[model samples]
Target: MEEFEIDPQDLLLENALRVVFKAAEMLDAEALTPSQLKDLSGALRDATEIVLSIETACGCDHDHGDEEAE
Candidate 1:
């Protein structure tokens, strides 16, 4: 068996990247109306906030989702 050092923040960042990439595929080479573009923008913004919440907590193990920040 092989063991490797894995940082939890790296895993979190990779997951966030996957989510953003999948969401971006929705707008790939497609003619999006203004409304659709706005919707996608909002979704991306929300995802950004969620990812940033980790930074807000200085990368603590605590989850900073939905509930108000302590």
Candidate 2:
């Protein structure tokens, strides 16, 4: 089998997905009987929104190298 390499952006996206899953697991473990599910769901929704925002903001043509001399 060949080794696989992942880009930094892929790693970031993976981490974000893991975090969202973990957040849901944590909420389940906490067993917040009194609290409503809306809050926990909202948190996950917000996290997804942030991920989309990052994708949009970074989806541009920006160079990593220094600018050329005029």
Candidate 3:
């Protein structure tokens, strides 16, 4: 079997994505007002950019090339 290595930044990014997904799942997109939808969209965009930046800074691939299947 091949051994796998985990990068701290990769873990962080994964956790961040999980949080974002959970938050999204909790909200009813169809029921959101226009303004609220806009705000949520902006927040998600910001979160995505921040996570991407951190991944880059840590030299981790966007696809988490080094991450093992859980």
The TM-score values for the models, in the order shown, are 0.52, 0.45, 0.50
Identify the superior model by lDDT, candidate 1 or candidate 3: 1
Give all candidates' CA lDDT scores: 0.75, 0.70, 0.72
Give the clash count for each candidate. Answer: 0, 0, 0
Candidate 3 accuracy as TM-score: 0.50
Q: Against the true structure, candidate 2 has what lDDT?
A: 0.70
Tens-digit per-residue lDDT, 1-70, candidate 3:
9999998777778877876886587584557778877777877887788696885576534566445554
* Model 2, residue 47: C-alpha shift (Å): 4.8
Local error of candidate 1 at residue 18 (angstroms): 4.6
The full ranking of all candidates by lDDT, starting with the best, is 1, 3, 2
Q: What's model 1's TM-score? A: 0.52
Leading candidate by TM-score = 1
In model 2, what lDDT does residue 27 have?
76
Runs of candidate 1 with Cα error greater than 4 angstroms are: 1-18, 60-70
